[model samples]
Target: MGTDNRKNLRLEVFGILKEAVSILCKNINFLIFTIIVSFPLLSFMVYYETFLFKTMVETWDLLSPRDYSNYNRPLPYQLITENMNRDFAYKLIQLGLLYLVPLHLLELFTMLLTIDLASKIYSSEDRPLTFKEMIEKPIYKAKLSSTFITSVYVLFLSTCTLLGLIWLVINYSIMLRNFIYNVLFTVIYGAAFVALLMKYLEWSAQWNVSVVISILEKVKGVEALVLSAYLCRGSEKRGRLLMLVFFAWGVCLRLPCLVLGCYEGGFGMVLQNVFNSLGNVIKWIACMVYFYDCKTRILEKKVDEEVGNVESS
Candidate 1:
């Protein structure tokens, strides 16, 4: 019975992807328009991310000049001078303000537009709104405000998660130097890591759905988040799976640029941006499909319970 249930869950995840693809194919014109609209923004994002990655690498190298021949030996922590640390911190702050903030805002704007179009497409609404029409809607401002709040909330949690992971790494490294405490540290760290990861996934699922809710409904900010959490109650597993699939897909698409440094220039760079934009489009559509699926499940379950109550009475 458990095996059957797991299989069914897997099928539902695939169903969401299949439905997203179906919608895209049926609306090729819409897809083309989305790609054209998204390409410039996404390309800038790709370039910005690559530039950020290279900057960090250069900064690290400058701080800790290492011999490539002695790759096996880890760099001594003591070698990093206080001045280097301060410089690194300053550089991070500069990058965050000038680059990261704008990047995130652009990403949110792209997602807002994509979700608006995707929801309409999925529902087969009469004459899907163009970019101008979408922004003109009175509710559009509410959606923007809600998404901004959501972004800030998510960013705060992300920073906390990063700090937690850093703490774990520092403690783990300290424990590694003391053989006697290895086993205890390993057990405790393993449990903490798993707990943190599960919580992150749970919140991520809620965050994605909440974005959809903010755009489609009148609800904004905390209310949308609360509704998302409620709707995802019985379908948490499916939500996690959907998140993982897209996360993996995105990583796979961008991994080559990171590994090969192909994003430097020319045709390779153009191809990367194009593919990333398309992936972004599909990912939002899949999330919209998943949102509807979860909503339908919740509604059906409620109807079933109401009928059962009637029968009992």
Candidate 2:
């Protein structure tokens, strides 16, 4: 049994990495598709960075040497308070939002395309979808709606969790003066923390397939959330394991940026963006694969249970 368990663990590790590579190899067109769609955003990023550099230089020059000596504070605070012009900052922000909004819209369009492409690749036995067909026929409404709802759910849960932690910390600190109260508070704090953590994990795991559900089942909003919860209830560990693999894959892909930063001089920023975008491509593929895997497992398990019930009867 132990040997079997160890073998399973080894296989699980091997499988995820192997599948990630396999997906990358099989999905070169998707990378091309993403890169093409992302060009505008990348252009904006480069332009904005250069503009920011020039602005920073101008701001620094505007602050005379005498101004620096007047304030005994951190450079960052001084930049905001002393050197920084509010009107300039406001203008920068306005200029920024103009590009940023469109960039994000392009990102959304790219994601829709990717999600459509993944559904075709994974969920069907059909031939690979061409980019044109993928875009033309792909469903968008459910994906958009479910994503918005999921975002709200995540934001709300995250906010509540943070507030709860802060409250616990503050109350626990105050109660620590009394020995009995401290002991009682510790137990309560530990319990609350564990409960909240578990809840967060469970909700997060359930939302893993919200996108897949949106694409496959045409479910949206709260209905999608409810369905995802129903599907993912018993697969919390697997969901978390997949998430870890996704995180690790992302970090490994971008590790070169850190290495390059250490050795390379000015051109490192350009290389970093290229590497990061490439990493994003890999990240998108791995994530879609993970989503498909989770959905498949749930569906197979569900079918098996139904079959077992039929056989027993």
Candidate 3:
């Protein structure tokens, strides 16, 4: 029974992908428009990521000690200092404001537009909206506000998760001098890390669906998040699987650029941006489909329960 349930969950994830593809094929014109519109934004995204990677490498080279004389020092000593150079800090701040912030807003807009379009295509009731119409909707303001709030919350949680992992690593290194204790600590830390990661993934799924809820419904901010959590009650596995699939897709798309510094202009770079944009379009579409499926499932289950109660009475 458990095995069958697991198989069904896996199939549902792929089913979402299949439906997304079907929607794309059925609306080739829409797909072309999305690609053309998104191409510039995605190209910027690729460049931003590659630039960010190179910047980090350069920053590390600047901060790293030139001498290996203290190589035997503890892990905490090897970590980057809190007191970063003022010039470098200012440059990073400038980078964030000048490039990162605008790019992030653009990405958010792209995702929301894709979600709205995909939802329309999936429903088959309303005609697909034009870009201007999409932005001009009254709900667009609410979506933008809510999605921004959600993004901030997600960023906070991500920062906390990273700090927690870093703390664990530092503590583990501090205890490495004691063999048995280190072994026990390692086991406990490993378990804790896995648990932390799983919890984060679950929250990530809720956060993602909340953005959709914010767009499709009248809810915003915490209310949307609460609704998402409620709707995802029995479908956590499906949500997590969907999240993992897209997360994996994004990593695969960006990993090569990071490794090879694909930011340099070439045919390969253009192809990467094109494919990345398409993937982004499909990802939001799949998420929209998944959201509708979860909603339908919850409603049907409630209807079934009410009918059973009526029959019993």
Q: Which pairs of residues clash in candidate 2, taking residues 3 or more apart in a chain or in different chains?
A: none
lDDT by residue (118-232, candidate 3, tens digit) is: 7766665435545566445453576677777766665566658756875665556544544464677767866787677666667777777887887777477778788889988
Question: Which stretches of candidate 1 lie above 4 Å from their native place?
Answer: 1-11, 56-87, 98-100, 125-139, 162-191, 263-270
Better of 1 and 2 by lDDT: 1
Root mean square deviation (Cα) for candidate 3: 5.7
Model 3: per-residue Cα lDDT at residue 214? 75
Order of candidate numbers by TM-score, starting with the best: 1, 3, 2
TM-score for predicted model 1 compared with the true structure: 0.77
Worst 10-residue stretch by lDDT in candidate 1?
Answer: 1-10
lDDT of residue 146 for candidate 1? 76
Candidates 1 and 2 compared: the better one by TM-score is 1
Candidate 2 regions off by >4 Å?
A: 1-17, 41-106, 138-208, 248-266, 310-313
Better of 2 and 3 by TM-score: 3
By summed lDDT, the worst window of 10 consecutive residues in model 3 runs over 1-10
Q: What is the TM-score of each candidate against the true structure?
A: 0.77, 0.56, 0.77
Clashes of each: 0, 0, 0
